[model samples]
Structure formats: structure tokens, C-alpha cells
Target chain A: GAGVSQSPSNKVTEKGKDVELRCDPISGHTALYWYRQSLGQGLEFLIYFQGNSAPDKSGLPSDRFSAERTGGSVSTLTIQRTQQEDSAVYLCASSLPLRDRGRAFFGQGTRLTVV
Target chain B: SQQGEEDPQALSIQEGENATMNCSYKTSINNLQWYRQNSGRGLVHLILIRSNEREKHSGRLRVTLDTSKKSSSLLITASRAADTASYFCATADSNTGNQFYFGTGTSLTVIP
Candidate 1:
């Protein structure tokens, strides 16, 4: 339980439905990240959360993608009106603040499948 | 957009051989990190090499960074069957707010 933990390791959703993936970071890490990896593809940056600063939504693919971190520890990535293209392995990572080097610890990830 | 791109999309070698993967980035980076992922699993952090560092080693993993070339490499020595996985290089740019962009990755298969 020392590393990042993700719930519902796999989820299947109907197209147009909503899905929320959860991530629990290592207790003291202040920087959390969300990324997606499509089948046979590389990881894609989604959003970033760091210690109360504004969440970086720059990498979000569309308005349907959103994420929030509460109390700087647990985070959730929500996708509304999901399309087939939204299917991917959603990964969460946490690390010491950006200042303490960029090493990150990752969770098992939630594999989201939209049909 | 992805900032890093890896070369030789896939590699296969016999156990006890060495495996190397290279990555090239488009922008200046503060640090580059290597990660490994077995099929259907989350990424496992391998090693990180800062821009200021030329080379770093961790166990059987060795990472090297070349700021001038805007590239990095990860080397795994004495590969094993369990080493079969995908390897990716992520870059943290100098002023990109510390958000890391990942590379396409190289799928490595170390056969016994």
C-alpha cells in the first residue's frame, strides 16, 4: 500500500455514458498526474495536480475530460459522454514536488473500455 | 502533442544479452526518466538522468542524457525473460511546469 493505488482496475462503459477513475497517491507526494495509453500506443499526458496550484489541463484531449484532486492526496479523472475513442488505460502517478527531482511512482491503472 | 519519440519500435534479444533503447526529444528538458511496463500493467520507474548528468546507473539499468543532442538512452544489461516489456522515456522540460511527456516506447522481448 506504499505505492499509488487505483480502483476498479477495469471498467466497461456504454458509449455516451460517464466514467470516473480513482487514484490514491502515495501519502506524502504533492505532484499527481493523469495519463492515457491506448492499445499498442504510448502514454499520453492528461492533466497534472500539484499542491493546490491550478490543475494543468493542457493535455486534456477534449472538454469531456476533467480531473480533480482533493486534499492533495486522492484524485479522480472523469470522462463524460464517452466515445469509443476514449477507451484506454488510464494511469495515475505521484511524485515528490516538482522541486525534488521528477521521479514518479505509478498505479496499476484503470483500463476503460467504451462500447 | 508528444515531446519524445523512441527509435527501433521493438527489440528482441536472447537472455544474457544487452538491450538498448534510444529516445529523442524536441525541446530542452530538465530531466529524462525511463520506465518499464509489463503487458497490462502500470509503468515501473526505471531510472532518471538529469540534464546536467551525462550518465547514471541503477542496478542493471544505465541511463544517459545528452542535452546537446536533445536525446537519451536506456541500457539494460544481462537481459532476462522477465525483462520482456515496453520501455518508455519521459521528459520534463525546463519550463513546462514539470509535466512529463512520454515517448512512444520500445517493446523489448528478452527470450530465454
Candidate 2:
């Protein structure tokens, strides 16, 4: 892909339902990140996946929020038992290996609205 | 808690004026990069400055980093209405350089 790609640009799910957002990073990139942003706010780090390393999950707001990256290329962010507070834009980014000091390229985010 | 915080949450300026935004982080960083977002969607990478480098320039953008203070600033010269957008700063931790944290963005409105 020419840039990072995300699926289901907009999602509106009932509260208590589960929704999954997907991200496909650029080929050969070794790092991926997920972030959530509320209306008019800065991005909140959600999770980070580095090549073959344990993901940094410190930023997940709660146990209901989880994400996984498969084959070092695609990632899925799952929000279980979603609440109204879960409404926000989910952004995914990918970068080159850390050794290369690469800047992140972002995808057109998924806007999730839990009603 | 590792997130960086940008100052002046919102700014408004006239075209041709310089716009400056500051960011401060808590820990040491291997490098810092700036991004611009429009319409609250995807962000575009603007500039990156390694920890060892004090300053870098790209077109009308100038970035400066001070490791000792764990802070960085982005300056846009001769701004235009098209430059209006939210700007964010991200840092890669020096320890692992894998954890990338973004700051609350500074929204700049360039009035023509």
C-alpha cells in the first residue's frame, strides 16, 4: 500500500456490543501503533507493536480494550462491551524500524460511535 | 503518563505570520517528530529531529530539540490558510525507542 490503511471508516454500534477496527500498515514497516482521540482532543496512545516483541499495552484504557498485530503487518483493535465513552476516532500508524529513525505514517482513522 | 503535552491548546494567526508551538515530555527520547492533522483525520509527518541534533529545517518548517529540557518546538514561517490544522508532537523513548507517544495537539487557525 502507498500508505497505512484502515477499514470501516465509520462505525456506529450499540452500547455493550463489540466492534473491531482493522489496520494494514505499509509493507516492510517494522513498527505499528494505535491511538484514540475524542472530539477536539489530542490522541491517546492505545497500543504499540514492534517487530517480534511483546506489545506495549500500558495505554489501553481498560481490560475491555485490546489489540493484536499479526505477521508484523496487519493489526486489529477490539473493544469489548463497548460503552458510550468508547466513541472516538481510532487511528493507526506504522513506521520503519527504530534503528532507521522513521517517522510514522497514519491511516485514515476509523470513527467509532457507541450509542 | 508518557505522553507529551503541547502548550497553547489553540492558536489563531494571520497569513504571513510565524506560528510556533511547544511540546514538553517527561522522559528521555531517541527522537521527536511533528505531525499535522486536518479535519480530525489522518496525520501527515512534518519533521523529525534526533536527540543528538539541536535543530533541523525543512522548507518553511523549523524544529528544535533540547534533550536537557526534554522539550521541542515547531515553527512554521509565513503561514497560509491552507496551513490551518492541528499539530502534534510524538516522541520515541530512548530506552527502547519503540514506544511512541503523542501530545495533545495545538490547533492552529491561519486566517487569510
Candidate 3:
């Protein structure tokens, strides 16, 4: 693809419902990351996937938040039993390896609204 | 947790004026990067300053890093209304390892 792509640009769901977000990273990029940004807040680190190695799940806020990257190209973020406080924009970015100075390209992001 | 903190949460300036924003971090870093976001969409990488380098310039953007003080500054010369967006600073700590911690960001609005 020309750039990173995210599905379901906007999602509105009632509380306790499960929601899934998808991200397709730029080709040949080996590093993928997920971030959450609440209204009027900074970007919050969520998870990181690099190549085939085990993902860095340290940033996942809770057990309900989980992500998986298949074929090192596409990724998905799932939230079980969503809460109103989970309403925010979920962003996905990909980089060329995990270099200290590598630039990350971001997707449009999914705005999830838990009602 | 966020490692960088930007000062002046919001700034409103007229076009053609020089706009400067400051960022401070608590730990040593391998590099610091600046990014811009329009509305709440995707982020655009603007500039990056390595810890070894004290200053850098690209086009109308100038970035300075004072590693000793654990702080950095971004100066946008001759700002334009199109520059209206949220500017964020992200820091990567070499010792602590991978990932970048983003700052709270500074929202700049340029009035034409």
C-alpha cells in the first residue's frame, strides 16, 4: 500500500460490547505500534510488534486490550467489554526496524466511541 | 508513561511570525523527534535531533537539543495558517530500550 491504512475510521458501540480495529502497515516495514489518544490528551503507548519476535505487550492497559500482527503486515486491536472511558482514537504506525532515529508513518486512526 | 512535557499548552499567533515551542524530558535519550497532527488524524514526522547533535535544521524548521538540561526546542520560522496543528515531542531512551514516549503536545493556531 502507499501508506498505512486503518479500518472503520469511526465506530460507535454501546458499553460492554466488543470492538475490533484493524491496521495495515506500509510494505516492508518491520515495526508496528498501537497508540491511544483520548480527547485533548497525549498519545498513549499501547503495544508494539517487531518482525516475528514476541510483541511488546507491556503497554496494553488491561487484560481486555489485546493485539496481534499476522504475516508481519496486518494487525488487529481488540477490546473486550468496552467502557465509555475507552472512547478515544486508536492510532497505528509502522517503522523501518526499531532504529533509534527511524521515522514512523501513521495511519488515519480509528475513533471508537463507547456509548 | 509520557517522557516529554511541552510548555505552553496552546499558542495563537498571526501568520509570518516565528513560533517556538519547548519540550522537557526527565531521562537521557537517544533521540528526540517532533511531529505534527491536524485535527485528530494521523501524525506527521517533522524533525529529529539526536542526542549527540545539539542542533538541526530542515527548511524553515530549526530544532535544538540540550541534552545536559534534558530539554529541546522547535522553532518554526514564518509560520503560516496552514501550520495550525498540534505539535508533539517524542523521546527515545537508548538505555531503557525501544519505543518512544510522546509529550502532551502544544497546539498552535496561526491566524491569517
Candidate 4:
């Protein structure tokens, strides 16, 4: 893909339901990141995947939130038993390898609304 | 907690005036990047300055990084209404280059 791509631009799920958001990064990029943002608020780091190394899951809000990157090209963020407070835009970004001075390119985020 | 903190939560300026936003981070960083978001959607990368570099320029955007103060500033010269957006600063930790943290952004409104 020419740019990072995220699927299901908008999602509305009932509380307690599970939701999954997908991201497809640009080809050859070695780093990917997930972030959550509320209405007009700043981005909150979720997780980071770098090459074949272990992912940094330090930013996941709770045990209900989890993500996985497959084949280093696509990633899925899953939220179990979603709550109303989980409503926000989930943004995904991909960048060049860290050794090459990674500069992030973002995708149109997935806006999740838990009713 | 966010590594960076941006100054002036919101700013309003007339078009053609210069707008400057400041960002401060706590830990050592490999680089700092500025991003702009419109309509609460995806962010567009504006400029990046490395730890060793003090300043960089791209068209009307100028970025300065002061490692000593762990601070950076973005200046937009001759701003236009199209420039109205929310600006954020992100830092890549020196210890973990892949870990990126973003600060509370500065909302800029340029009046035409």
C-alpha cells in the first residue's frame, strides 16, 4: 500500500461486545504503533511493534485490550467486553526502521463508539 | 503518562501571523517530531529534528530542538486559515527508539 491503511473507519458496538480494528502498514516498514484518542484529545500510546522483537505492550489500558501483528505487515487490535469509555479513535502508524530514523505515517483512524 | 508536554493548550491568531508552539519532554530522546491533525482524524507529520541537530527547516515550518532542556519548538511563518489544526509533539525514547509518546496537543485556530 502507498500509505498506512485502517479498516472499518467507524464502528458502533454495544457495551460488553467485542470489537476488532485492523491496520495494514506500508510495505517494508519495520515499525508500527497504535494509539487511542478521545474527542479533541491527545493521543494515548497503546502498543508498539518493531521488526521481530517482542512488542511493547506497556500502554494497553487494561487486560481487555490486546493486539497482535502478523507477518510484520498487518495488525489487529481487539477489545473484549468493551465499555462506553472505550469510545475513541484508534490510530495506526508505520515508520521506517529505527536505525533509519523512523518517521511515522498515519492512517485514517477507526472511530469506535461503544453504546 | 505522556513523555511530552505541550504549551498553550489552545491558540488563536490572525492569518499571516507567526505561530509558535513549545514542547517539553522528560526523558532523553533520539528525536522529536511535530504532527498536525485536522477534524480529529489522522495526523500529518510536519517536521522532525534529531538529537544532534539544533534546528531544521521545511518551507515555512521551522523546528528547533534543545537537548539540554529536553524541549522543542515549532514555528509556522505566515500562517493561513488552512493551517488551523491541532498540533502535537512526539518523542522517541533514546533507550527504546521504537517507543513513541505524544503530548497533549496545542489547538491552533487561524482566523482568516
Candidate 5:
């Protein structure tokens, strides 16, 4: 792909329902990351995947937030039992490798709004 | 725990003026990167400075890193109205599997 791509540019879900956000990173990139950003707030790191290694799940806000990367190419961020407070823009990025500098390419983020 | 913090939450300047934004982080970083976001989403990588390097430049952008003080700054020279956007700084720590922590961002508005 030309760059990182995220689906469902905007998502509006009701409280208690679950929502899934998707990200397709640039081909051959071995590192992927997910971040949540509230309006006018700093980005919150959620999860990260580096190659076939176990994901770094330390940043997941809660159990409700989980992510899976299959084939190390595409990723899915699922929010179980969504809450109003979860309303924010979810950003996905990919880099060449785990040690690559801060040159990650970001996607156009999926705006998730829980009503 | 967010490692990076940017100053002058908002900045306004006329086109052709120079805009400088400062970022301070509280950890050992291998590199620091600056990004620009327009319309609240999609960020474009502007420049990256390795910790070992003191300064780097790319076109209209100049970046400086002070490892001892754990701070970095981005200078946009002769800025244009198209440069109006929110700028963010991200710090990458190698020991942490290259995880990055981003700052709240400095909103730059270059008026025509």
C-alpha cells in the first residue's frame, strides 16, 4: 500500500455495544501501533505489535480494549462494551522495524464516537 | 505516563514569519520526531533527530535536540499559511521496544 490505511473514517456506536477498528499498514513493515486521542489531548498509546513477538499490551487502557495483528500486516482494534468516554480518534501507525527511529507513518485515524 | 510535553499550546503568526515550538520529554530516547496534523487526524512525519545528533535540517524545517536537558525544538522558517496545523513531538525509547510517547501538540496558525 502507499501508506497506512484505517477503515471506517468515523464510527458512531451506542453505549454497551462493541466496535472494531481496522488498520492496514504499509507492506513489509514489522511494527504497528495503536493510539487513542481525545479532543485537544495528548495521544494515549494503546497497543503495539512487533513482528511475531508477543505484543506489548502494557498500554491497553482496560480489558475492554484489545487488538490483534494477523500475518503481521493487518490489525484490528476491538472495543468491547464501548462507553461514552471511549469517544475519540483512534490512530494507527507503522514503521519499518521495531528499532526504526520515530519515522512511523500514521493513518487518517478512525473517529469513534459512542453515543 | 506521557514522556513528552510541548509549549505554547497555541501559536499564531503571519506568513513568511518563523515559528518555533519546544518539546520536553522525561526519559532516555534514541530519537525524537516531529509531526504535523491537519484537520485533527492523519499526521505527517516532518523530521527526526537522533539523540547523538545536536541538530538537523530539512528544507524549511530545522530540528535541534538537547540530550542532556531532554528537550527538542522544531523551527519552521519562512512559514506559509499552508503550514497552519497542530505540531506534535514523539519520543522513541529503544529499551521499551521502540515505543513512542507523543505530546499534546502545539497548534500553529499562519495567517495569510
Candidate 6:
């Protein structure tokens, strides 16, 4: 079975620019989540989608960060007017609904570098 | 915000030795999961223990959960060089809908 995958495994962008990171979750996964991991830091929750309904967005650092999941599938995270502080590894994960707890599969992640 | 913290930022041991990592969370959780990441790649799920369960074993891996203390431990028996990587424990709070809070992780080096 194909696993969750992300695009642009590595990206380098100048500050003040915008970046879009994409995630393709495994087939049939009803839940998708986006997280950010800074150097030597723990995984920070960004947003989560369960079957097109997002119940949590409080983790987004600021207005510049937003994410959308369409058709209960793929998700995209957009960082508008990116800043140097926004640089980090953006991770995507999916699971087989809440019933299959603690078994979320993750993608390779997009390493965004804001220069 | 992070809810879990792993002790001993790093650990190094011989390939045949046992490796143990501990994690403590601040809130009640439905389940505690352990993940392994090599380099900076996406993490791979290693094991998961529900809050009600006290202990579990898979192959050479052993996971124990103590709800009273809000902590968990992962023990890898007879580890191998390929086990060298970072291990993280994530807690899924029951109040939250499938949102997992992760720890800072422990970097383990298995010297062959």
C-alpha cells in the first residue's frame, strides 16, 4: 500500500514570499493532520481535518498559515508572506479514522527553508 | 503547545544492548504512540498502547504505560545498529479529536 507522501521534499525560498506545501494521504484515510517540527523541537500541531470538517486550527502560529483538505482527501498548507521564522519541516500524517488510534502514518515531509 | 517530554535527550549503546526511553505527558490521554525517524524523514509508527493497558510487547519492543503518573516507557531488547535514530512519544488526549501532542524525542545511537 502506498503511504502518505508530500511534495517538494526540500524547498528554499526568500523571506516575505509565499509557499504552498502539498500532502497526499493514503487511500481511505478519513483523517489528515499537519504539523511543524523545528530544529531540536517537538512536533507542533498546526491543523487537523476529519472528513472535510476541521475542528482545530488553534495551532496555526498566525494568519500567514492556513490549510485546506478537499473531498476528504489531499490537503494543502499555504504559508502567506512567509518569514524566516516560518522555516521548518512541515509534516503530514493520516490515519484510518479515530478507531485506529495511535497508528497515524506520516509522509516524508516538506523541508521549507526561508532565507 | 507540547504536552509530552522525553527524558535523556540522547542515548548511545552497543548493538546488542537494551535501549529504554521514557516520556511524560501533562494531561490524560487515550493512547500513547511511539515513532521512529531516521534523519529528517517522516516518522514511522513503532508501537501504540492504550491508556487502559498497562504494557505491550511486539517482537523485541516493549511499551509500558502508567496512567497514574501520566508517563510511558519504550524498551527495545537486543537492539541492532539499524535501530539508530530518533524516537518520539505522542499522546492523544481524549478531549481532543485525534490531535496528538509529541515530545522532543530521544536520539539513540546503536554502535555496531
What's the CA error at residue A108 for candidate 4, in Å? 0.7
Tens-digit lDDT track of model 1 for A1-115:
5899998899999999999999999998899999999998998889999998898898999999999998988999999999999999999999886556858899999999999
TM-score of chain A of 5: 0.97
Q: Comparing to the true complex, what docking class would candidate 4 get?
A: high
Kindly list the per-residue Cα lDDT of model 2 for residues A5-95, writing each as its tens digit. 9999999999999999999999998899999999999999889998999998988999999999998889999999999999999999998
Better of 2 and 5 by lDDT: 2
Q: Please state the CAPRI-style docking class of candidate 5.
A: medium
* Candidate 3 segments exceeding 4 Å error: none
Writing each residue's lDDT as its tens digit, candidate 6 over A1-115 gives: 3999899899999999999999999999888899999876778889988885654788899999998987888899999999999989999999876555737899999999999
RMSD of each: 1.2, 1.0, 1.1, 0.9, 1.1, 1.3
* Fraction of native Cα contacts reproduced by each candidate: 0.67, 0.76, 0.64, 0.78, 0.78, 0.71
Q: Give lDDT: candidate 4, residue A109.
A: 98
DockQ per model, Cα = 0.75, 0.79, 0.75, 0.81, 0.77, 0.74
Query: Number of clashes in model 1?
Result: 0
**TM-score of candidate 5 on Cα atoms, chains taken together:** 0.97
Please write out the lDDT profile of model 4 over residues A37-112, one tens digit for every residue: 9998899999999999999999999999999999988999999999999999999999996657788999999999
TM-score of each: 0.96, 0.97, 0.97, 0.98, 0.97, 0.96
| TM-score for candidate 6 | 0.96
Better structure of 1 and 5 per DockQ: 5
| Most TM-score-accurate candidate | 4
Tens digit per residue, CA lDDT, model 1, B1-112:
6568998799999999999999999877778889999885799988888889999999999888889998898899999999999999988877764688899999999989
User: Which parts of model 4 have CA positions greater than 4 angstroms off?
Assistant: none
> For residues A5-115, could you state the per-residue lDDT of candidate 5 as single tens digits?
999999999999999999999998899999999998878899989989899998999999999999989999999999999999999999976475537899999999999
Error of 3 at B67 (Å): 0.6
For candidate 2, write residues B77-101 as lDDT tens digits. 9999999999999998888777678
Question: For model 3, what TM-score does chain A reach?
Answer: 0.97
The stretch of ten residues in a row with the least summed lDDT in candidate 3 chain A is A95-104
The TM-score obtained by model 4 is 0.98
True contacts kept of 4: 0.78
Please write out the lDDT profile of model 5 over residues B17-93, one tens digit for every residue. 99999999988888899999998898899988888999999999999999999999999999999999999999988
